[model samples]
Target: MKLWGGRFLSKESKLMEDFNSSLSFDKKLYYEDIIGSIAHVKMLAKCNILTNEESKTIVNGLNSIMSDIKEGKLKIEGDYEDIHSFMEINLIKTVGEVGKKLHTARSRNDQVAVDMRLYSKYKALDVIDNLDIILGTIKILGNENAVIMPGYTHMQRAQVVTFKQHIMAYYSMLSRDKKRLTSAIEIMDENPLGCCALAGTTYDTDREFTTKELEFKKPVDNFMDGVSDRDYLLELLSAFSIIMMHFSRLSEELILWSTKEFNFIEISDEFSTGSSIMPQKRNPDAAELIRGKTGRVYGDLMSLLTTMKGIPLAYNKDMQEDKEPFFDAVDTVLKCIKIMNEMLGTLKIKKDNMHNAVKRGFLNATEAADYLVNKGMAFRDAHSVIGNIVITCEKKNKAIEELNLDELKSFSDLFEEDVYEFIDYENTISRGIKKEM
Candidate 1:
């Protein structure tokens, strides 16, 4: 099963083989490996490198391997060097000697590069699909529950905003995340199959034929870059990191809102958990875990950056370090998206509590200043007057709205019966949204 044993007289030690083998994780690339191999085989035959009958025989063996592996007839695990070895080794064993020709113009370097690109290309699309689902769920929440709430600055109520505006902030972040992934896919869409180890082949290989057969956008122009470039992965990891950061922000708010003090929303019982000692616990474990996993995804990105930073040209064993972290990030973000979407769908929005919080926190304080400005008071003077009014209201244990006209006029002559309408939460949010238009 060792692919490079011609020059080696001594058998490889078990420990070294174990250390060097990537089949443990890269077996995840089995389907990609076989599919790329099929494309390469067909290209080889089309270019007359293999007889038509020989190409069919190798392809048949490759197809049989896929069926047997899927059906559990073949267990694709052992002391093989990697999935490429396991595959070509099995292909030869299955279809006799013709199976050896399947790798006629390919190198494991290009083979693995193509496999990883193929894997990332499709998985990125899956992540986008999940993002779309999450976006749809959030749009529904923002539309159905249009209640006004106190928007925060530095964790303190700063202004009036609707629950819709708050949730849609995440929608914006995830939408950009989807686009980042799409762009990364486009950048890595060139077919790298014929690059072959880095130097390419002397044989008259038709890379364009394989490119079209494999459904890539085009063939890679540089043999060295095709096998060596992992910029696509770094771009994708960066996108996934941004996504987790957005998830973490939303998760922090969800955890805070589910608490007794906030009482703004309730996570469903299915996503909740119990404490071992406290019988009254219904923890927002789903949101909490999502927040924690954000760090893990960040680490996945950093891990690859460190791994790829020092490695030099063409191909290196160091590149094998890339797959696990990349796969981990993909799995983490997908799970986070799925759970968050479900959690958002079943949430119980506490509109009354949200409204009460808005009122209690002087969310309309900014509106009071704007109200004075409308009455022709200088904005600076209105701001100072509102500051004093807030202090007095806090000392009196009263909201700004609770003060009567004479009490409000003591601070400023701009106060009137219409002040109530101007600072109403609904009117405040409406005016706030209108300013954007």
Candidate 2:
């Protein structure tokens, strides 16, 4: 039986039941729903809204259902409106009349709100758990690999930076993502259990008591907004999209690096795939899939944004649209983090290829120009001198290191043997804050 519909004479149509049903997806919230109910039941008995005997019976019943579900003795199947109905019906079966008392001071509106928040809380931490793994793996990669590579802008070699400097850029990004995920939990930690039907109940419900029982930081001050708003889910979806974007960027670089033309890194055989016919095709399919799935997570955020836009306040069925997208984003982002961590773990950095590329790209031309400025050349003149040397080198198909000291002096009288030391890629990369490396 549904938790409501005492006045309606007509039964819900079969097709309508199918359309309105959320048991397919919201069944995932069963654990959260039951946990929320247990807290609510304890508060009801304390307030005398439910007798002590009634509350004890209901709590025992709810725990039994939770235990059965956990041990696979119960299946959450059958036609049910949502997890709340699935819970109430089975609850009534387990505890008889006392189970019916479980809904006394609460409505499914607050019931569902608390369920979503509780689920989001734990699931967000699960995302963080995977992020910690990725961060640790990235730290190990940066420390273990001590190769210098070309840093780029507009896909052209711009300056000299180390492999550590490059990968740790993502370390910085994911650290911020971890912080964002953590903060989103705090913003969502207010308890919504007492906000019955939006306006709240006339019953002397102790919201604060339930708040403490549920381990929420505080009770939501406005019952209407408590049941109405879904800003927490949107914030997490936004954060998840940003995280996918970061991984996609790194995936793009890795895919390029694995190519024969770039030849800068080798993806492990485990993370790569071969073509159907061609024997020589070890495609970077794992990274490509990660890159491609980024759009899927982006779509999850956008779908919820659209669903929530123009939605009326005080809870609408449109709010049901939040769960699938939220569920999808958490799953996608966690999987992406796992796959990306593994992909990065198995990569082989081609030190020779990176160092050779760094040599030819005039990546150290800034140091070349800086050497002139140290020798008292005007800053603009120093920049101009380096630009001329690059063009001359390009025309001759020769690296700056290939130029004799006299040829370099032709550009600037400041040119000396020591200029070579300044332009060396190793020295160029040492524009360092020591502890970070």
Candidate 3:
């Protein structure tokens, strides 16, 4: 029988039961549900709603159920409507009539609210921990590969940069992602356990007590908002999407770097795959998959955003649609971060190839223009002189630096032996341009 089936004389069809049941996915919240219930029962006993002995019995039964589930002794199966019902049915069987009192002043509405908040809180922290690992890996790579490389804009080589600077640029982006995730965790720290359905309960319940017990910062201010709010979930999904965006950008570079045409870096065999027919094929499948998974995470955020946009105040069944998307995004981002860290940590940097590529791209053209400007040439005239010099170099099949000093002086009297220093790749990086910019 359904927990709230007291008024209905007819039984629910199997189709309705299957359609309405959330135990399939919500079983994942078994630990969270039990933790929230234990806190609530403790608060009830503190308020004199349940006798001390009755509360003890309920708490012990809940703990036993938790232990059994953790030990793989209790299988979360059968036709219970949701996790709350599954726990309640088992609690009753474990402790008899006293177990029923555990739900005296609460509803599944507030119960689910607290469970989800707890789940989000912990998962957000877990994501931050993984991000810290990624950040550390990036810092190590940045320090190790501080050699000069060509930086590009619009897929055309535009300037010279240190690989260290390039790697740390991603580090800055992930630093912001960490801050955003931490803020999301703070936003979800309120307890919703004592709010009951959509309003304050008539019982003399101590919400503050439950908040303290459950380690939430405070109880939510409004009961209706407490029951209906999914902003925390949305905020978390937004964070996840942004993090994936950063990952996708890095993955794009990794893909390009691993290609033979670029040959900037070599992915390790452990993180790469081989083609069946192509004897020389070694693919950066990990990076490619991380890039691909980014779209699915974005879709998850959009799915939840669209679901919540039209819902009314207070809890509704539509809110049930929020879980799968949030869960999938969280799982996807965590896995991506783990794999990305491994791929980055194991990859080989071809320092000579990177420096050689920088030489081929005329990345020092801007510095040549700057050199003329420093010699009292007007900035526009300096740019024009460098443009003509580049055309001449291309005609001769020579680099600007490869030109004789007399040939350079022919372009402008401002050219001097120091022009060679100005075009040096390492000197370009040492010119005080900020890495993050």
Tens-digit per-residue lDDT, 1-437, candidate 1: 67789899999998998899889899999999999999998888899999999999999999999999999999989878999999999998999988878888889999999999999998999999999999999999999988988899999999989899999889888998989988889988999888999999999999889899889999899999999878899999999999999999999999999999999999999999999999999999999999999999999999999988988897888989999999999999999999999999999999999877887888899889999999999999999999999999999999999999999999998799999999988888887789854
Residue 116 lDDT (model 2): 96
Error of 1 at 205 (Å): 0.6
- What range of 10 consecutive residues in model 3 has the weakest lDDT sum? 428-437
How would you encode candidate 3's per-residue C-alpha lDDT over 111-145 as one tens digit per residue? 99999999988999999999999999999998999
TM-score of 3: 0.98
Q: Mark the regions of model 3 whose C-alpha exceeds 4 Å error after superposition.
A: 433-437
**Native-to-model Cα distance after best TM-score fit, residue 237 in candidate 3, in Å:** 0.4
Whole-model lDDT per candidate: 0.92, 0.91, 0.92
Pairs that clash in candidate 2: none
Give lDDT for model 1. 0.92
Q: Between the candidate structures 2 and 3, which one is better when assessed by lDDT?
A: 3
Candidate 3 lDDT score at position 10:
91
Q: Can you tell me which runs of candidate 2 are displaced by over 4 Å? A: 433-437
